[model samples]
Target: MTTRGPLLAFLLSLVVGLCLTVPAGAVQPDEVLDDPALEGRARALSAGLRCLVCQNQSIDDSDAPLAKDLRVLVRERLKAGDSDEEIIDFVVSRYGEFVLLKPRLLPQTWALWFATPLVLLVALGVILFSYRRRKALAKSPKPLTANEKRRLKRLVNED
Candidate 1:
């Protein structure tokens, strides 16, 4: 039927949109803590921690087994009465700082954070320098001497 074409297109688009979105419940029911307060802390921590396998997705949004493991580890730390800072420190010690989506501001990391701005400033300087040079070069030439004018006219005739 002619009507089926638009309906099929609408259904396909709806399915595609849903597929592209991150699943809200990547953490299994088993991983949820018994205490709501601890569970909320675990969820918040999971959201900040990057999924090593997925790279871009947070552990809370990633379905990777390693992400699941990390989530469990965070909950376990919470159960043990570790402060949020201590839990993060423990993970960072084991996995290195790459596990964090946002790199810490350390002397070594200063370059990583500043590289983009430095590059942009250098590029702007180069652009401004070249623009000034071109503008400077565009100034009118000194008036040709009578002899030079004669030579130019002669050269034009030869051409």
Candidate 2:
């Protein structure tokens, strides 16, 4: 009886953990294609495309009407025998590059891609400069004033 209680608790926690860890996709049953290969391709493509209505979520993971539309469109394109690249191009042409979860590296996007690292480097340089300045100041003690030196000399004489 004692062992059963611990076992039940462990099983309950395991089930809850599994439920939390599983991905919650928004793809409906009707949205799935009969052909597993085509469906797999559609899912892969959908995962790369962003849901414009839910900016942070992929179309595959979003429940927005627009995301559903995009998923359906992707499946339709696959059924029409469009290659993955062609479908991606068609969507990109219609919606612009912002629909892509990862934007293509181009001349214009170079700055966009590098901006974070550039900012980080600049911040690191500033931090290092400040640290070095503080260290240098600490290492070299401030010179004693003339009055303080005289006081020290008189104290030594009394000693």
Candidate 3:
């Protein structure tokens, strides 16, 4: 109805959109360490661990109860003087390696990591072979027999 009304509506929508995009850390205040270094390490590890309930989201980004439990477990392990690797290994053992956002390179995961590239290469080879074969066929002209030429002449005359 008025410029002021439309402008106010636009401003309200902009504020709501900005609020939604603001990154909210899922870690609770009580779980934070006094030592900044340890807290930093805990945060890094949390970022790599996948939330089981929210498969694609990291434990650091997820709001699930299981994610909170994992965050607490990681902090506890850090306080107990566990190395980052040990804490990760403990979680992996408990939940299986699927909990890791980036899986470790090992015999078990070789196919998982390499299968897509292998399949892509195979598909590329097939496409190239098909293209080359089609090109070759096109380049090599087929000799028209006498009957075909006669048929062509008759068809042209009929038209």
Candidate 4:
């Protein structure tokens, strides 16, 4: 009975953990509309936005206040008859390009977009150069003359 009690408790906890409750204030009720298509569009747009409060997570995945605010903003834009691009541009203008999960391919942002690969290539070249230099340093020159070899051996042995 004692073993069964612990097992039952563990199973109950696992079931509770698996139950995904949206939580109070995670999403505002007013943001969702009667029209399923518009709600779906709002959801899709929200998924591409980075939550400022949870920098690595999309607004759709985040439960933070800022994420909720962004979600509402998307729904509001949709309700106002804004096209997807217009809504995205509005958010980008308000929050800067950092709000976008995928940055635009404009001239201003091009260097930032390419910097990571360039830095990686530079790092790889540095590593290769160091490895070659170390290998060169390890390779010994031809053996010295008999007299020189004897002198070197004596000095090394004495040390």
Candidate 5:
């Protein structure tokens, strides 16, 4: 009964902790578009942008002031009748391509993108060839005379 009480209390606390919602105040109401479709587009654009301050998070998810400013800028661009691509281009021009979560597939970007997989394939082929060669060497019977075997066995027994 005593153990059960502590366990129940812990479980209750865990449940309460899980239910608590952390408020994200990154995007203010004024930044949102009045049109629902435009607002959705703004959100989509924001999500695609990487937060410069919080490098790992999207601008949509980051609470950094810079991220908020970027979000507001996106909304403002959308309100100014800028197309999604135009808004993206505006931001990309301001910041580098690193600002985009998914970068454009340009020639330079393709080189960076394809380099890893090509390198991995070359490494894998080398490793597999080495493994097969080692196995073949291990399996191939070594030539040994009866005299040599006898001498080897005697040496082992002496040791």
Candidate 6:
């Protein structure tokens, strides 16, 4: 056999080995659904779930054990014939709204959604108030007392 034949075969084997060893995010092979449509829905739901252990990463993107469990839970919910919203609401009820990447706009979440704009308005008001006060002060002059007027006359005479 030629050296080229052996070298090509070794390179191909190495590529295939590397591909097989790399884990695809948190989804395991056994967790995937046989139905492509259901599998797609599971993936979508996983992407929306915040992994409690990982905090910032979605269950679909995190490798934490909790994230894997959440991924499996999402698949199970899908298999049970739950609609996407129902599955999401079920998870939210168990984990609180923190499990959602984008939390719903509810009374409890109003402060979170409105805090920045309210703070900005307050800051802008403070800035504008201070600026107007400084401008008014600059425009008005205080009258000097009689003693200060006499001192000014003496200084002018000396000059």
Ranking by TM-score: 1, 3, 5, 2, 6, 4
TM-score per candidate, chains pooled = 0.80, 0.73, 0.77, 0.65, 0.74, 0.69
Q: Tell me model 3's lDDT, rounded to 2 decimals.
A: 0.94
What are the per-residue Cα lDDT tens digits for candidate 1 across 41-141?
A: 99999988999999998899999999999999999999999999999999989998888888889897899899999999999999999999999999998
For model 4, residues 1-159, the per-residue Cα lDDT tens digits are: 369999999999888876744323345576676799998898788888989998877888888888988898898889899999999999999999999998898888998889999999999999999999999989998779999999999999998
What digit string (tens of lDDT, one per residue) describes model 2 on residues 36-124?
99999999999999999999999999999999999999999999999999999999999999999999998868887999999999999
Best by TM-score: 1
lDDT of each: 0.93, 0.95, 0.94, 0.86, 0.89, 0.90
Candidate 2 residues lying further than 4 Å off, grouped into runs, are: 1-21, 141-159
* Location of the lowest summed lDDT over 10 successive residues in candidate 2: 103-112
lDDT of 3 at 61: 84
At residue 21, give the lDDT of candidate 2.
Answer: 76
* lDDT, candidate 5, 37-140, per-residue tens: 99899889999999999887789888899999999999888989999999999999999898999888888689778889999999999999999999998896
Candidate 1: the clashing residue pairs are none
Query: What RMSD does model 5 have?
Result: 4.6
Ten-residue stretch with the least lDDT total in model 1: 16-25
Model 4 accuracy (lDDT, Cα): 0.86
TM-score of 6: 0.69
Candidate 5 error regions (>4 Å): 1-25, 142-159
- State the lDDT of candidate 3 residue by residue for 118-159, as single tens digits: 999999999999999999988968889999999999999998
Worst 10 residues of 6 by lDDT: 20-29
Q: Residue 106 of model 1: what lDDT?
A: 89
